[model samples]
Target: MKSVLQQLPESVLAQILENAFQWFVVVDKNSRILYINEDYCQFLEVPRDQAIGKPVDEVIENTKMHEVIKSGMAHQASPHYIKGTYMLANRVPLIVDGEIVGAFGSVVFRDMNDWKKLSSHVRTTMDKINMTSHEAPNKLYRLEDIKGSSKAIRSIKETIQMIAPSDLSVLIEGESGTGKELFAQSIHERSERAEFPFVKINCAAIPEDLLELEIFGANIEPEKHHRKGRFELADNGTLFLDEIGAMPLTIQAKLLRAIQEGEIEPIGSNMTKQVNVRILAATNRPLEHLIEQGKFREDLYYRIQAITLRIPPLRERMEDFTELANTFLQQYILKAGKRRLVLSSRTREYLQNYHWPGNVRELQNVIQAAVYLAEHEIIEPTALPEQLKQVRKKPVTQFVNLQDAIEDLEKMMIQHALQDEKDKRIIAKQLGLSRSTLYEKIKKYNL
Candidate 1:
């Protein structure tokens, strides 16, 4: 006897499955996507071709297909969050001749209205609870919040995923506005300490006199009220120390002892307390240079940098500029209660040409300002900040004389050849010029 699936034609079977389930996907034993229906691809906003052959988790957020494959257990009517909605999904291991070969998954929302009604009810219940609750939820950034598809961004995200599961101390290095704090939050969110409090303190922002008290709380002199320090407050959690390079040498020694011993002694107290805390430190300045100058402790630097994650500056990842700019523009537009606005070609050109010294933060500020300044649907160059408009890639100077143009081209070629080849003979040979002529041109152009 043939089963119903076997009885039906392949095309007919595929069509039935595609229409029956709102989203469907299949992954191999290795957890690489083998097949995904068009509906699922459309819902994910990823092209079917692009999604195929990728890891299931990379393609679908919060997917359990891999777990299904691993455990060979079927999950029915499980709530899975995708994008912004909670979906009822089913996952089952695919078996052939009593051997598990892969996994099959589907999100079943037979009636859109039914899902909408359920969602509305859940939202109302949550709203009521939130209104009565005194404690507010912590605003911690997740891995997805670090937006960018550039190679550098992807590499950093992959590193975070690999390191976040461990209790290793991480040193995040980047420019002033490269979203170091966001990355720190992402690490905490992905770590085992996610449910615990995530404490943060700026070493540069606090005064030296009170810095010790801030990190290791002080007992009140008159009342002797015992206050919890950041280390104690973040016990069994994560503490992010921003601008760690600016920490005074006096405090650096204490920090080293605390990290090394997993203990801290509060100010005005002789007793020491043990706390299980994961430390994540960040600095815009090079700690090595500071160490050479005797401003930072080398021992402390070694302790914190169990792993280092360097965030690329915005200027280095210009490929992501348009997407980032648009994201910020939309965010500010919604805040201002305005309709959709897009950057004009000229405005984009100006933004792309300028060197973003302040990095992602500066780009966000620029877009926020443009959102309000834009009079129409399109943001013109005039809507951008004055500095961005003024500091553009210098326009190519036009050559008037043929001799001058030839000399300019020769100089550029010789400079590039010299950079590639250290030997003058090799450079001359590469540039197809005589050694004497190359030397003359090099002296003339001052290469």
Candidate 2:
């Protein structure tokens, strides 16, 4: 380039720059506007003469042009909010003969609708980034949102249906991300107390000092704004205690008494308020093991375990992964405003077979991240999270004993024979065994 500005006349240069931007403003070192285009003045609804003499910030809401002038540096390609709208702007120092005299600024898409259309895609990408990178949500799940076709899941649903109506203390045990809260809500909704509130508190999330105050209402001074605890708020309804195993042994005694007496005595209070609350407690920790270690109270365990349910980890229920994964993928795809992104069959199979140590939550998170990274509408296995992509299916285990090994081998051979040749005699002949022997073996192995 041969110094295009030098070759051009001042009036010609002004006309070209005016046409290039939706809005333009030039400010001197004092941040006093030296020049502003007619469009910018019209957008601000101020006359060009008035805008030129004033500071850019005084004229525009949320202006950062003053920053560029102060720092003598460029603030390029950054989002600048003006009048409750996001705009792409670049503010660069105007250096004349190696001396910083002023700054030049230009904006694109002054129309709010145009900015919204452009920024929507950016927002979608930002949401994806947040979903993948941030911590797990305190997600509330409904009974219908629960995904699984496995017998285990069916049984879990049936159990909730059976037990939810009852007024008993239910203890839920599972690995983290097994959706303990999901099950708890299902039970609550199915219960007679569904019309009332459902209050949940993670005993581990609150500090030990504040945990007592949170669970049992405090009777401290200035009682006007003093509020009820989880127990009082959940009166005549369901109270879900997450990570109940994390409660200190000292607090366990008080909790046990509350359950046993059907009332809670707040700290620093002699009076006990009667509460008809059904307790649903959950924990990833082994309560029995904790009791044995004397870290948890045995009496507390008995009180909470009046009705116990254990959710099997995701790896154990591989049959459900495909459905669960797609459910998550669909939710996130709609959230990101992307298409109905499809997962390749190979990707689905790989996901189903992989060991999900973090369970359904991990699967959902990985899918969200994948949806963000996917180039096309179809998400390949390569788009999966780094942890999931590195997962290798474990080799099938060998039989423990010679008798078991021989039995499995015989069973496999018999199944293959039956699959290929339907007739009993033909199957026997193919296996080099007599029909009677084959029948006896089939009956013995229950195959």
Candidate 3:
């Protein structure tokens, strides 16, 4: 009996092969190139004519594919990371009757945009929830979207990546709106239990008596049907407890019991039910301070803080300020149905000087509010918050780095020069630097 593929006509087979995503190629037993698809050549950044006569090794830079062909074994390969981009390819030996006939392979480039699309789809479909806005895909949180380029932020991301797949408990510490929950979700999404439910409960939102019942489930009388709590719902998955510091000291004992003993006894029921749940907790308050004040239990703290991660605030990582500002601007402009707007030179200066006490969430809200209020195409100083407009003249000796201090002085001088002359060339000549150098310094300091 012949397979359906083998039963097809030559023309039909040719059309099916041409339209396929996986590029196919055939090589003779002697390892000479015989036939190749248009994509196969295109993937290698070579012409079809150039690829047809060349051997697999000659066409492809990596010899892995060629080795698989000669060995008469099928090979599966993922994106070959090159120049900060992932590229994928696969090679398989073609067998006919009892003889090794030839080899075939396929290749494709895995761009950042494509990965974002795939990640968004996976996040949406697996969670069956609205993880992000429908308008943009790349806006979904990544290591780059964390609003920080500091070594601390990079270290936090690296730690999360290392522990995301582990079952150990994680305690994330950060200020309010510093994206602690976002980090928790990223861990859940990357872990082995990604397909399982990710349940979130705010410890501060629930009363002490109700918190236990909410987590450990409650029993109903024989007359009524009962409901299960988050633990049961999130069994074999993950439960993110936000504001863990806000949990009552009394209930903390129960939580410890549940953690130590994998079973939870309901409020009314005497029997304990086993639940397998991974706990990911976050808090803004300092647990050590609470421990000193006798508000937080030290035992429970140690239990939950098997691994701790500190998320840096926006002010600490100023290098990411411009990137985050531009991202939020693009986001809210489309959402608010306003004309495209870019931050003016003055606006950037105002943003850089103003301390972001509210972190990334505050920045997002500011952008949305500014975009909604702006009448012009470009965001001006007037469009900014009132706090930003009140820039105070402070002493400049705070910077320890003299070079940075000099740049700051030069920027202030240039701003003053611009006000008087209104000419960049004149300002450059007066500053005793080239026009290109002046422009470069202006951009570097975001003057």
Candidate number achieving the greatest lDDT relative to the actual structure: 1
| Order of models, best TM-score first | 1, 3, 2
- TM-score of candidate 3 to 2 decimals: 0.59
* lDDT measured at residue 50 in model 2 versus the true structure, 0 to 100: 59
Clashing pairs in model 1, backbone N/Cα/C closer than 3 A: none
**Alpha-carbon runs more than 4 Å astray in model 3:** 1-147, 222-224, 392-447
Candidate 1 C-alpha error for residue 76, in Å: 28
Q: What is the C-alpha RMSD of each candidate to the true structure, in Å?
A: 13.0, 22.0, 14.4
What is candidate 1's lDDT per residue for 255-292, written digit by digit as tens?
99999999999988888999999999999999999999
Tens-place lDDT per residue, model 3, 322-414, is 657766775665445443576778887888777778988888898888887787887888888899777754334354567645654665676
> What local lDDT score does residue 13 receive in model 1, on the 0 to 100 scale?
78
- Cα lDDT of candidate 1 equals 0.82
Please give the range of 10 consecutive residues that has the lowest summed lDDT in model 3.
132-141
Sorted on lDDT, best first, the list reads: 1, 2, 3
C-alpha lDDT of candidate 3 relative to the true structure: 0.72
